[model samples]
Target: MIAANNLSVNRGGRLILDQVSFQAKKGRMLGILGANGSGKTTLLKTVTGFYPYQAGSIEIDGKPLATLKPKERAQRMAVLSQDEHVSFDVPVYEAVALGRYAHQQGLFAVKGKTDDDIIRKAMEETGISDMAERSLLSLSGGEKQRVWLARALAQQPDSLLLDEPTNHLDLARQVALMEHLTKLLASRQLTVVCILHDINLASLYCDDVLLLKNGKVICQGETQSILTRGVLENIYGTAFHEWKEPVKGRKQFSVVTRV
Candidate 1:
């Protein structure tokens, strides 16, 4: 499990996050939601140790996140950021294999058959096996995103952090990725904390939801409880309409706007 207690962060003398507290348990996906500049990205970065916090603590599986060595941390957690860029042209296979570095004995360690198998499995799972030999630069935006996800999967971390993972994908691909994550959560028991702008997608896939407004957590709880039209309207300052799916009985919502 990953937990943040009274976490706070400041940048350029301005507070970005304030005393935010939440926990993502094993085998569950936690969706972080907010409007622009609500510190959604900042919270993810702080929990992953990319940004130093001014107060509070982050723990992973009962161990202080700060105390863990770099390799140790990488072995337990993996991050998939919004940007997917490669300075030089890199083969898809090579890019995904980078995740295994934490498990390597040394910088020059030779990759054995086990490493190859894991890479192959990751690529296959993400539906990029056929593109293994292609240059990452040649792939489309959605394809590149899938490759990045495959790389993170190859890491085989206990917890995965994703920032706007569905940004470049179409509706179909977006749903497919969420379904894949659901399988990963149930089969591998992977804990996921994802930053999402689409409230409907969060409602469909998230087991828990954390709503933030102006760097403060407005509410956090089961997805159904926290994502009511009132709470969403208060946080986004917009009107919303909600309805239930006739087949699944799941609640679906849409923003209401007048021309």
Candidate 2:
């Protein structure tokens, strides 16, 4: 499990995070939801040790985040960034194999049979095996997203942290990615902590959610229970109406517009 206790970060005379606390448990998808500027991305980055926190602590499976070595951390957590616009001049298989870098002895280490198998398995899991010999630039947006996801999965990390993984995808691609995540959660014991902007998407995909407003947590708990219309309005400072989505019976939002 990944836990953050009283986490806080200050920057340029402003507090980006204020005593944020939440747990992303094993075999669950925890969606971090908030309005823009609510510090959702900052919190994810801090957990990855990319951004420094001024106060509080982050723990992975009861071990302090600060104590883990770089390779150790990489082995435990794999992050997929929203802006992962890679221009790497390599085949899909080679790009996915890059996820195994931490396991290699040095920069010149070659892929062993096990590494190749893992890489191929990851691509197959993400449904990108056919693109193995293809270049990243040749794939479409949705295909590239799967390649990136395959790359992250090849890390074989127990925890996956995604920063708006659906950012540049079309509607169908978004559903496809989220649907695959749901299947992965059910099939494995992996933990997912995703930062999502779409309220309906979070409601549809997240098992639980953490709501934030102005760098402070509004609430965090089961998605269906905590994501009521009133709660969403309070967090976003706007009027909203709730309705059940016909397909899955999940709650969806329709913002009340004053025109």
Candidate 3:
């Protein structure tokens, strides 16, 4: 399990996160929801040890995050950030291979058979196998996102962290990515914590959610409970209405009025 206990973060003397606490259980998807600048990305970075925190602790499977070595931590959890700026002109397959750096021996080391197998599995898992030979610069935004996801999957970690994984995706790509993620987590028993702006998507796919407002955790619980219209309104500062889908009867929340 990945957990944060009384976590806090500050940037340039300004507080970005305040005593945020939550637990992402094994074999479950935890959605982090909030309006822009609510510290959603800040929290993810803190959990990954990318940013320094002013207070509290992050624990992964009972081990304190700060105590783990870089490679050790990467082996345990993989992160896919929203602003993954890959300026290189490498092939898609080669970009995904970079995810295995921690597991590799030297800079000139050739990929072993196990590495190739895992890369192939990750590519197929993310539906990017056919794009393996394409250059990263040549693919569309959605395809690049899939390549990044495949890289993280190639890490073979127990936990996955994604920041806006659906950003810039078309409707079909978004659904495909979410569905693929759902199946991957369930079948592989991988713990997931994702930062999602789409509340409806979060409610549809996540097992639990953590809502944030102004850097503080406002609510945390099962998707159906925490994703209510009232809570969403409070968090987004907008009036919302809940409705059941005509075809599936699944609940969906939509903002209708400014608050």
**Model 1 regions more than 4 Å off:** none
Q: Which candidate is the best by lDDT?
A: 1
Over the stretch 26-124, how does candidate 2's per-residue lDDT look in tens digits? 999999999989999999999988899999999999999999999999999999987778766789999899899978897799899999999999998
lDDT per residue as tens, model 1, 168-211? 99999999999999999999999999999999889889999999
Best candidate, TM-score: 1
User: Each model's C-alpha lDDT?
Assistant: 0.93, 0.91, 0.91
- In candidate 3, clashing pairs total 0
Order the numbered candidates by TM-score, best leading.
1, 3, 2
Each candidate structure's TM-score, on Cα atoms with residue i matched to residue i, is 0.98, 0.94, 0.96
- The parts of candidate 3 lying over 4 Å away from their true place are 246-249, 257-259
Better model by lDDT: candidate 1 vs candidate 3:
1
The per-residue C-alpha lDDT of model 3 at residue 215 equals: 96
Better structure of 1 and 2 per lDDT: 1
Mark the 10 consecutive residues where model 2 has the least summed lDDT: 81-90
TM-score computed on alpha carbons, candidate 2: 0.94
27 Cα displacement, candidate 2 (Å): 0.6
